[model samples]
Target: MTIKSHSSRESRNPRDFNDPRNKPQERSERPERPERSEWASRRSDRPEGATRERTERSRPDWAVRTEQRRSPRERFEGGDRPRPPRGAGLLAELRELDRDLIKMIARRSRMLTRLPASGASDHERELRTSWEEHASAVSRDPKLIRQIFALLQEVEVAPADMEQPTAFNLAPMRKPVNVDLPAPASDRLPRVHMTLAASGASECVLHGVPLNNPVMECLKGLNQVGARLRWEEDGRILCQGGEPVSGYSKSILDKVVHVGDDPFNLFLILFQMVTRPARLKIIGESGLKFVDLAPLRHFLPLLGARLTSVVPGQEGLPARLESSAMLPSEVAVPADLPADAVEALLIAAAGWERPVTMALGEHPEGRSVASKMLPILRDAGIEATLTDAEGALSLHVVPGKAHFGVEPGTGINLSAAAALLALPALAGGSVKLRGAWDATGDDQTREGVRELFAAVGLDMRFSADCAAVSFGEGLGEDAELPPLKPLTDLSGLPSSLFPVGLVLALIPAVRAKGGDLPRLPQNTDMTLVESFLNQLGLSCEDGRLVSIAPASTPWASPSFPWALALSLAAFLRPNIKLVNPGIVTNHLPWYWNAYNSLPTPSLARKSAEEEAAPAPSRPARRRVLASHTPESEMPDEIVYPDED
Candidate 1:
């Protein structure tokens, strides 16, 4: 059957209606549509039990037994349904409904996946328009999709062709009204800034500690440029930074600057200030997992640094960068730039002698950390302007006095933290995560986690300072956990939070299927989390499904928030301490408070080896060995791709 375009359907040739087969009949003829079913006559033509008795009499007894074992639906509508009698119009409508539903579903799914990556195209708009029009033609209610599915299954006859009141076999549905809350904003203005106003000494402490590599790497890179860094026993970083290095040593030439696991953002400003030509590198040897750094190769060259070979592919890491002395003060933004890279440029530009202008192909708005940084820069006396011409964005930044001794506070990992607090704490009561700056929160990350949790009967809402939480409707004690919804798109959830998400999500699977040991998202440190979970004495196996039996909390992993969550979910302790609590502190400055606010401190489980091991042999031991430092470093043992 051919579906006509909405606009031209009324103008079809008059003769097309004459055949009656090509056009729909008037509503007055609807009664005749149902009277046309000839199946009842076919069934009545045979004497009751005659066919079965005759077949049994002619064939073996086993043949009669086989016919009695078939299901009713199978017996009535054979695996292949024969066409209905009376012109087979209902059959045609059912087949057409199935065809249209399948086509629209495939097209809509594809279009939605593409729309998010690239802005909508003409074809996309047309598809959307056609879909909406087709939907309206089928049903005016919001339950149109469900109705179409029902019609295809013969639960209801075609609503469009129904002229009789009882044409529909489906019962009327009474769905309750659900009011949608306002969508949360996407820009959370969590930023790291330097106020050169602290002193001429050039001392500043970065807040994002990222596991251990980034912190160690940051110290190494800064120390090479003449800075003194120390890890305070209290978990705060103290840096008695000195003057910035003006040159790279001759020994360092013709070699990768091996910045260890330090975040590449350090290079944004550190490379921009060279008085002469220099060579630099950003290596992720200690950590393979990270955000995209390719944008930096495009971004730094504008600031007098030329980058080469961004080593990490889409899923790998540890990028290589080359730096030159001259700086580029004005350049257009690349098609894609990392948030860290953009913020780094903005902060680094402050130390420059002249103003810098970074133009963008499109406005990021609240979608990126860089876009939100503009207002903060403006507030700090860095002249900043967001201009749009023909829908493109150009940010004009004027240099201002840089400061030191600044505290760039925390932006809670909503997904990680929510999976930590609310999901496990459902039995205990409300979980309070105070001290988070919601107004300047990471909008993209929060929204991503929110949308994901909303699917499985979890609800979270934001307020000043913290997020209020609750379980979804229809959930109660003895109620089974909601079924796991398959995730088609991973873009909405940040890669960093994927580990914790997996930890919370796999719990139900364990409960339903005894155990589930799925592969962790290798790109996001699932392997590391697996190690941690095993160390904590969970029934987890390497390269195997996770098992949740005997004290198992369905799903439990050694991941950041999940480990913390499992502690509260199945086990509780009055006073506890974690072996590597720094993982939480890396992203959050006020992690202690966040943990303390929870009703209990059960997350303090440590491996038996860690508890029984002797204390460090030295008074102060650096995480990265001194034997690996520039003065007397060991030869590089780079991990090859094929290595197990």
Candidate 2:
């Protein structure tokens, strides 16, 4: 019921000035403000000033304990939505109770630090007794309160005195290994699918790791437009679907309207789907600054949405969509939409009242959200037709009522195979990846993953439902690969693979910096890669061809798995632990177990450094392989004849 804008939350002033980070910067120490090109012809058009520092770092905000109170006359409400007012009489009592409980816990915690080891048993018993007494008291004299007393009972009795927490270095986790190897792949993460619910909940139950930022923001977009979403304790994000902001109403969000800096992939299309008489203006910031939003600007207006006010080529956001009544039956989709921007568009288009034909000038890869949407859209009672003329793909959609039933799941991620093969243990061993194909028969992206493996020395094989790859003898030495091959249309591979590709390309060039990376069709978010590597003790600088490198500090931090695996396999180091490693669940939660299963390259006679060379001085090349093509026409390396 309450929408917390991640962007706004991050920008909020820290409540505690006591935090060491909030210390005022010395006048000389403050970093100089960089010159911006914010083209503000009017004062109102100028971007919010606090916006930069708010997004300077991609790290997540500290979880705010404060509950968002809904307004009495709240937007989109038909009944009383009770919200506890903060710092008032009743709520203030709850806060004081919370403080008292915390203090009690802190007191007990401090007592453990002073208690003698010989007397720790007695101290522990005393604390346990106190907790039991409190629980029994609450049971007997239960007061009608805001449930603060539950905290006291939930406290864990501490060790009178135990080991103090110490920071541990996790670099060796990725230290390159030398061993004979084989690897396995599994589809373990919860599969998330779009539900065609005409009424009731449009539930997206998370199957694997908990939702990360990008995924969270995508769902949050749905939440803002009337999808009542809440995380069930079982880890499902249950969304009561079809509650669009039909008309203008106030959101708790401060009135400076803009889609905050977070990137919402295909979810942005939901803005158009929101019940109109409502005006939605999404302003892009930071990572989205360079994205060309021409497709949205050109096409959204064709629908009953107004964007005539948006000044072209000046704003980071696409054209503002003011809901209108006129709808276009036919529209052409541009070839340049980044992967994040296209999903919501397809769903919205498919659900239109009349048959809508979308002309996709050229679809380079069949693994993007767009590719997956073709089948899902069809299953939703929309007649989806694919016609290719001289290899250009055009989709014709005939609108029909949506029906709920079983559809195919997303394809298994094979980027883990790249990391596994990059390991030195597999220099001469074989690797097989099961669960690479989707029930939807989406294999194009899986092939791209295999293609990246092929760029090294791995040979790949595919089946109706599975895939495998093997490495050659002394593979690491003979393979003089480039620093991550340019990340173009990634064909639905995990975005983390881009950085992994960079690491693997350096298999033969440990001393060399990375190569020029192609901004991908998926509009890959390097922020996560940067955050992952930054935690890994490496620094990430964004550019068309970012020369990826780490600070001069001793190489460490195993936060990012692919980044860690790349470093270990490329550099041959000890296995390390991931800082907040659980974040991997967003893209490849299962890869962690698969990573541990991989044999460490601890036995290599020669390290990646011993065989390292100068990065190849070569111009970028576009290598597009024809799908379902004859083996005779394809390169020996890229060809994979599916076994019957």
Candidate 3:
């Protein structure tokens, strides 16, 4: 349809497509851009040919910008600053209060320095009471306040102060004689006698109960509440049950019972309060001062007992317990109550006038205190049954006439055993531990003691009489012993024994510089242990032992196990001094005596050196001349003899 377009296009251009000289016509219809607005144009004060940037540089706005600059202070004043934090005011107030507390403590220290040294005991008692009351009023820990005051007492007010605090030392016992430790009496004996008396049982005789300070305190407290307990010359405790007096008529001092830091003693007192109508003031010492008895406070009300803290804000002893005559027959025990607490409850239930059924929520394991205690309760004539119904365990205790039929078999005190076991390895001598078996048929603690020795490649021999701990065969020398086997499993050991176990465990970990350690129990408060370890140049975190150049510093602690461990460290480094060695009295009253009796490591080394020394020379004897002359006379013919 467009056949003529080629010729028409060729004629219009009039040149070949490839021609170099071809030219195209320009179009005249394109429109020009409009003039820029005033904002885009340069300032009028500059020359016409000047660039826009040069014109702006000479403008008067620069002077105005310079004049408008403000200081940071002016900006803040004008509300250009950031907002303050939420609790800034409260944090400041708290800081002020802390400062005031420190100042008051310093002032008290100065005043104490100025006071005369006479009547120091009275002053100390008054100060302790005042500090404890202040701590309670201010919602603080009494233990922490007491520690602060103890430290202040240690501070030397003036160089002339002659009556410094006593710091017991173990150096005097460095070269002691042979140590034969006395057989440890059973710890369960005290609990047994106390529980039986609280249960309204008839008078019974208990043999082998050591009349230690803690035991004596318990006996005295029981006597105050009308329980007839007397220690005979033959080491038998005769406990006669009596009705405890109730109400506030008794003097506060008579009602006040000092437990001396044992939770078991406290539990027995709590049991006595619920078993009979009694008004008692319970006081604790040492670490038990911080024990929170909230669970008991909540549970005791069901048994018609009112437990209240003597200090308003605190929750533990010193506390007051008041009970009514009405006793509940059916009581549901809290599931999470401590196993020891449950045992105390079961013991106390035996004295109830009516049979009380306790709905214990869960069945305890074999190692639980309740499990071991159930059999003892049964043997004591109490009908105690532990049954499970739909996963909930209940204890139905039927009250009966209970008596101590046979001598409760003697057993080793756990605390003493733990400390004594370490002596053989540290002091290079054998230690005989008696009463290792429990008459109640629970040897869990005894087994734990065995494991503690076994971990360090030591041998513990058990006979009918006692258990003896000594070096394993062929491992008498320290260097000959094998590598310490890591004791990772700690289920066999009770938490109370952990302090000794932990120190023993660290021996290998630190000596080796890196190794596995026993994992810390989830429930243990390792504040003291961690602090002690830090002082020794070691760090423990999540069961990992990181050695940091251990130092041989003097060890001082109120904790018996900690002090015991440090004293044992002298075997590792002989220079490590033990300060406050008398703290061992808290557990083993005769520990220092027993420990002092042991041969010192240095003395043993000195003896070894003497054994290695050369013996004195003996004078040489001259031979007789007559025997030599007879041989010379026969020599001429004898010299002629020849070999064939």
Candidate 4:
């Protein structure tokens, strides 16, 4: 190196071509890169297993996974799809179809209107039949289709001319009547029936029998079932029992009997059928036709019988009952059944005359009904034992050796009468109810009736004879009655009085705080009751009556009791229009006359004022009873409440 020691640049200039540091080391120094396939094939430059890791590191995790590239339209369309139809065009077509269907219905209605009435009825019946058949063939509910077609028929056929309709009006009453009511016939009906059915070849004469529609219907039923019934001289009922009358239908008329709309009659008749192996096709009209007898299904099996609704897809009459005549010695009634149903069961058990045991689950109202009916059975000479054991109520019934006669007060219906009287009593008026007071019962107990009225903030007085009830008279004038106290316990109340108490209690409950009414022991369907009250001008909400107003439209009452209640309610709140006033005649033939007989409140007040006005010169005279003479007399200037 020392011998050639010239300048280093001069030394390496010729040798620079062969020097390693003088040449570019990168692959880019070559003119161009090889194809990808060729670069992959030349893997010798990488370590033996480092190629994968190096490639993964070089590209991101997302880029490492291979995927097919797609265009924006393809990505959003989710592959090829058919084009959507135009919404506007489809809606237009639907509207046109609806218009065509309506036009067809109108044309059919006009054609029906052109036909004669008889022809139209026949044609409509045929159409209904066809509709039912078609619905069945298509595996649809026939009843539902029948209802739909029936509605159409009713809408199109009635009142052919819409512009000039026929005028149908309800005869209006000028005033309400204040009439004396006898005790309930219900107390005596069972005894009468028992005497006819249980006695062997005995003739009994029944006098002063109420000839109300329900009573007559029951008599007719008893007669058809083999009891010889005839009207006797001096207005008495003569019933001759031939053989046992209760077990089966003895005559052709008994096979299909109409019980009208009276539940008492229906239950009594049905239970009579339950005692023997028999078949009955029971039917009813009006309100009875709509009663749901589904609850009876649970109790019938215990008596070896079956009750089935004849109407398809409905739980009401007309119904058919089949019995095997084999009854269980002991039966258990669940707590949830209605009160009337339980009473019907008891009636059947009493008729059977065998030692029968009934276990009533924790139903207080049902127990009360059983308790009341047991006395009736005992009066009919049946030995009945009601006991409370370990919180369960049970009744043991057996036939007794002694027979009892009907009591005097049995002629009156105190439940209905008391309910009716509540209307006038609440309105500050007097009602003279000339009913035979039960000497043995507590209903006529002056102290009890006084307490009942006192609970509602009304001062009531019952005469020592218990013939007349006077309370709240002249209260409507100048006197501000205390707010009606809410009645929380209605279990012990008379049947008719329950509704009155319910309305009074509900008024305050709704206006103050919205909530459900107190739980009823009867387990009544309060929804329906509330709805009915609202229709009758008691505006109900949240299961309570919020306000009282005039009913805007005419409403048809389901039963006579309901009609009576509604009429009384209307008297309280004016301008309510009720349709079908004649329906009440089914139960109370003299209902309209008696209903219109009550003097108007104004007239009552005027008469009361006249009575209160003392003679100008003479002092007011007081009749003193020697047994209860008072130390002081009421002042003439201070008017006393009206009394009979």
How many clashes in candidate 2? Answer: 24
> Candidate 1 versus the native: TM-score?
0.45
- The positional error of residue 169 in candidate 1, measured at the CA in angstroms, is 54
Q: Relative to the true structure, how large is the alpha-carbon lDDT of every model? A: 0.48, 0.47, 0.64, 0.59
Reference-based lDDT, residue 578, model 2: 40
**Per-residue alpha-carbon lDDT of model 4 for 1-644, expressed as tens digits?**
45654554353454678876667678867678799888887886677879767866898666555423444554444346556676978998999999998777777776867777777647766776676877787757655664556445544534545565332233333232344554334433534443334333345566655566666667676655555666544336666656565444342233877876676667767777777777778876554655667778777887888998764545656788887778888888876666666776776676564688888856656566676667666765677999887877889887433244753233455445555556544444555555444532333322334455566655444543344444545453545434566666655555455555555445444445444454454756566576556654555556454555534667676555566666655544445566766666654555555455545312122477778888789977899867754658645476779999
- Per the 3 Å backbone cut-off, how many clashing residue pairs does candidate 4 have? 9
User: For residues 1-644, what per-residue lDDT tens digits would candidate 2 score against the true structure?
Assistant: 98988776755367878776778889999877544543333533746864444544443444221112544445345435576566578887899999997787878555556668897547645665565567665565333221222233234555558764333233333322333322222222222243233212343433332444444554555455555656554445554555432223322221124343454543343333432444555544443443455555565665655553243223344345566535567666656655545555555554455666666665343235546667666654567877767755666776544454553333344455556555532244454444435542234445566676666545666666655554443445446422333334333445546655655543332333333333443555566545444332344345423333443333333334454454444242233334344445544444445455444432124568756744468556779887696868977576669999
Candidate 3 local Cα displacement, residue 83, angstroms: 36
lDDT of 1 by residue, 177-281 (tens): 121222211112222332222112345554433334344455455455444555544334554545433333221344344555434434442443332355554
Q: Flag regions of model 4 displaced more than 4 Å.
A: 1-202, 231-235, 247-254, 362-364, 400-402, 406-411, 436-452, 461-469, 473-495, 502-538, 541-549, 600-644
In order of TM-score, best first, we have: 3, 4, 2, 1
Estimated TM-score per prediction? 0.45, 0.48, 0.64, 0.59
